[model samples]
Target chain A: MEVLGIILAGVLVNNFVFMQYLGICPFLGVSKDFDMATGMSGAVIFVITVASTVTAALEQYVLKPLELEYLRTIVYILVIASFVQLVEIFMKKTLPGLYQALGIYLPLITTNCAVLGAAMLNVTKSYGVVLSTVSGFAGALGWSLAIIIFAGIRERWKLMDIPATLDGFPLALISTGLMSLAFLGFSGLFSNLVK
Target chain B: MGDRLLVTPSPHVKSTKTVQGIMLDVVIALCPAAIAGTVLFGFRSALIILVSVASAVASEALYQKAVKRQVSINDFSAVITGLLLALTLPPHVPLWIPAIGAAFAIVLVKQVFGGLGNNFLNPALAARAFLLAAWPLHMTQDWVNPMTYDAATSATPLAGFNATGQTAFTLKQMLLGQRPGSIGETCILALLLGGLYLIVRDIIDYRIPLGYLGTLAIGTWIFGKPGAFFQGDPLGAIFLGGAFIGAFFMATDYVTSPVTPRGRLYMGIGCGLITLVIRLWGGYPEGVTYAILFMNLVTPLIDKYVVPRYYGSGHDKMARKGGR
Candidate 1:
């Protein structure tokens, strides 16, 4: 039940982008077109899951034993950067078509705060490796769910005669705000999860 | 007379103002503040700024090349995002913080949104907001004191106001940037000078800043105590933190802000209201970061409803259509 709650909380009530406002750049930037948004979501899910797993191990094994906690931020960034590079190279060699589809957005995963944010939060919250991995997977699922929904709305929005001033980004932002408000209704569902 | 060519109907006239030119102008305008921050904060400031700008430009270039999209790193927008994120950060913030922020700003916010003209919010402000939420201590940890690193952890003027309901620095101290705060936020005069240069160069519209500040002053006066405007000094509040820097440079980002005059006014007013509310009641000390970001999120909506009447279009027709 606790595990289920954690998954539910991360996926809906405490959505990484809409409710918590963690990974908003990708939420807004990639959601313009559904296909691209889906690709970005897939990439984020993969990165978050893998990064969190590895970072948790590093924190538990290396940083704790050495008392080098202060170096976590620098080390995490380097690790993430290298990890993303490895993923890119691997994708290019083994999965050329998949790599071609997500090629442009792969390097983008390097700097995504969500990846680091998830890893950091895992350590900060003192979650066990299993829980952290669960959080990572759920967080990515939540982000993917939110962006795909947003993209669907935006596709329909293309037909509406939006005013000149709000035609592009402004309208998208407003919709996001409203979506946030809508998502707020789910807050009560996961109230009994984390604590 | 034998062969008069016909021009296609669209984007009627082309101006010399390319994305690259606008971005270059922004970089030039930000140079003064960048220099001031470095001079005051020491070598780490320059190093952090360099890393941020480089990371952003590199990410943008690499992403474009990988995706087969047009490479836009030369346009300097990514450079602007990097510098702005660096300026907003505490000088002592770990290198990775700025690096992460830059990546968030450029790859996630700017490039992923379709790049350049397509982003919905100012990338730097969005990244700052993310960092603030993710690491409140690191984001709010003040290290701007000039003399000693030990005493560098004091609250900023805004944080002072939020925590104890009292400002340690007087109006003059705060205005002159003598107070402890973010590196770029220390010198009000420097920020204004840079802002004025941008305005003069026509790099940014003056309406957004003016409207935002004006509304903020009025809102602070009304909500605050009788002398709060004069005593706490609303103008001081406006100048103290990232308000001016954010209002002029970050909030008025062309892609994120409104296009028409009226839309811009609404955008400014919305930001002012949000900032004031958060400052007075929210958990955070400084609200400019979230205020600008929240407004950036709503900019699209503001532009939608605040459109000017088309020539000869009936008001009723527009209203009926808008109501849908």
Candidate 2:
């Protein structure tokens, strides 16, 4: 039940893009089309989950004993970058179709602040390995849900007569703002039951 | 030639009613709630409504002029947005709250989305949710005593109902809008009249409201109580909170709702599900605004996948795919 609460909180209450304003660059960049958005969401879910596991393990084992917690950010970044490469190579060899589908987004996950944000949040929240992985997966799900919904709205923009100036990122940002406002309803959600 | 051939967004069904006609009917339908609110919440409520409506129109006109577009404020959609937003607000809020909310509704939610018929979410509800987020203190705490119209901060009956699943007010009182709540929402009688008028006038779809209220009734009946099954008060549940007004006015907004008949049913059901989740277990005492707003995000998705089969088309894959 606690794990479920965390997942629900991440997916709806503390949404990555709408609530926390993380990974917005990729959110706005890759969410132009439906297929592309789904592809990025898939890649993000896999990468963020994996990175959370590795980062939590590292924080638990190396940084805590060595008292090198200040270097955690740099170390985590290095670890994430290398892990993404490993996934990329592995995917290219075994899953060429998915590799093609995800394209550059697979590699781009290394720089996705949401992945880094989830890892850092795990450290800050002091979540153990199991909880960290769950949080990471949940955060990735929230981000994916946002991009997918945004992509659905964007698909209609193709037919809308929006002003040229407010056509692209401007409209996207405004729409995200409105969506975030709606999501505010979920703030402190399940406070009654979870506690 | 251009004037003869009109091109509009989705909802392409031919109708004798112009946009102005439909919006005017909506205004008329909403009049009962507005008047009931003014009377129930005293003169301050009336002031709030006026300020909100004026701000909304001014914002629409100013935005149109700034953007080099035709001023569309005369259609009364902005007026409706303002009225709806005001009705949803607590009566005792500083006048500027509704004003800012009205401006936010028109400029940010409506006009920025290409104005009437183009907005993806119900502008007024979106703005209400925005205000709730921006000023939680004012939005949640400003419910004045309904008839006495005093400054006493009375918690809505929903707060107690949330915990005890019991109500002090009878069905007669809830129907008469005697309970303490947002200015307009307390008056289920007026809102029902308005809803009936809209449905009778063919200004709004019946399916959406029916599906929404129906689902809310059944869901509340099943899960409204803490432990018992089928022990919840469905009548009290629907009459409470913003459910009635939201179902009849906001959820049925043509721009934000589904176009297809079947799709609209799904929209209402989706709204009911989300509202029940939030009110029951998620958060908050009422969930109408967020339920409708969240469903607004999925309106397009519903439209995409839930299309009705074209007449005379076979059920084959190619034939089924022909409508799109």
Best by lDDT: 2
What are the per-residue Cα lDDT tens digits for candidate 1 across B1-324?
A: 101111112334555566667678888878877887777777788998999998888888988787677786666778999999898988788888888889877876666545666555678877787677667688778476743433475667676564343455777766677766676777777788888988887768888898888887777656644334433456656866788888888887886777677888887887887677667655456778767766665555565567666655797787889996
In model 2, the runs with Cα more than 4 Å from the true position are: A192-195, B1-12, B313-324
RMSD of each: 14.9, 3.4
Q: List the candidate 1 regions with Cα displacement exceeding 4 Å.
A: A1-17, A20-195, B1-14, B147-151, B163-166, B225-231, B312-324
* Each prediction's whole-model lDDT (CA): 0.75, 0.87
In candidate 2 chain A, where is summed lDDT lowest over 10 consecutive residues? A186-195
How well is each residue in B178-201 modelled by candidate 2, as lDDT tens digits? 877887898999999999999999
Clashes of 2: 1
Leading candidate by TM-score: 2
Every prediction's TM-score for the first chain? 0.95, 0.96
DockQ of candidate 1 (2 decimals): 0.03
Which CAPRI category fits model 1? incorrect
